[model samples]
Target: MRVEEIMSTPVVVTREDTLVKHARDLITRKDVNAVPVLREDGEIAGIISVSDLAATHFDDKKVNDIMTKMVHVVLRNNRVVDAAAVMVKHNVHHLVVMEEGKVIGIVSSLDILKTMVD
Candidate 1:
C-alpha cells in the first residue's frame, strides 16, 4: 500500500514558536505521540515527538528548541515500505506526509505495525 493509504490525515500540527509546554499539552491532550511543525508558509519545518519533549529537562523551552529540524518526509504516493525504511534508517518513529510541499498527514510506527498485524 501507499503511504497515504496508511497515514493518518487531519493531523495535529504546531508552529515553530509554539511553547514546548503547549506541544507537550497537545500530545497529552490528543493522545498523539508527535506533531509536525509547520512554517508560516505552510511548509514542513520540523517535527516534535514525545521523545523530543521527554529528552529535555526544561519545560520552558520553545518547540523550536526541541523540535527535530531534520524531519524526514514521504510523498503520499510513496510505498509504505519506503516510509518505514526512512524511519528505521533515521531511528525515528514518525514521518510527515507532504504533498506539493504542504503538510497533509502523518505516518507512525504503529500504523505500519497495524498493517502487519492485520
Candidate 2:
C-alpha cells in the first residue's frame, strides 16, 4: 500500500495570513482534524491541527502564528511502512502528502490504523 492509496482526498488548506477563527471554521466545516497551511506562493508552509487550535486563544492571530513549521511529508507513492515510520519518529498524527512538489493529499495515523485492520 502507498500513501496516496490510503490518504484523504480533497485536501482542505488555509493560507498563512488567514485569521485563526477562519481557519478553525474551515477545519470544522471540512470535518477534518487538520489542514495544510500554505504560503502566498502556494507552497506548503506548515500544518494546522486541532492541537494548534486548542493551544491558543488569540482571536487576532493568524494561522501562521500557531501552525507547525516542521511539516513531516511523504511522497504519494511512498510505502505505507515508511510513512508510518516517519509519523512515529516525529510523533505526528498527520503528514502532508506531496506529488511533484505539490500538495496532493494527507495521511494520518487513523488512516494507517484502518490500513492495518483492512
Leading candidate by lDDT = 2
Residues 1-118, candidate 2: write the lDDT tens digits. Answer: 8898999987999899999999988899989999999999999999999999999999589899999999999999899999999999989999999987789999999999999899
lDDT of 1: 0.91
- Candidate 2's TM-score reads 0.97
Q: After superposition, how far is residue 19 of candidate 2 from its true place, in Å?
A: 0.3
For all candidates in order, the CA lDDT equals 0.91, 0.94
- Model 1 poorest 10 in a row by lDDT: 38-47
Residue ranges of candidate 1 with Cα displaced over 4 Å: none
Each prediction's TM-score against the native?
A: 0.95, 0.97
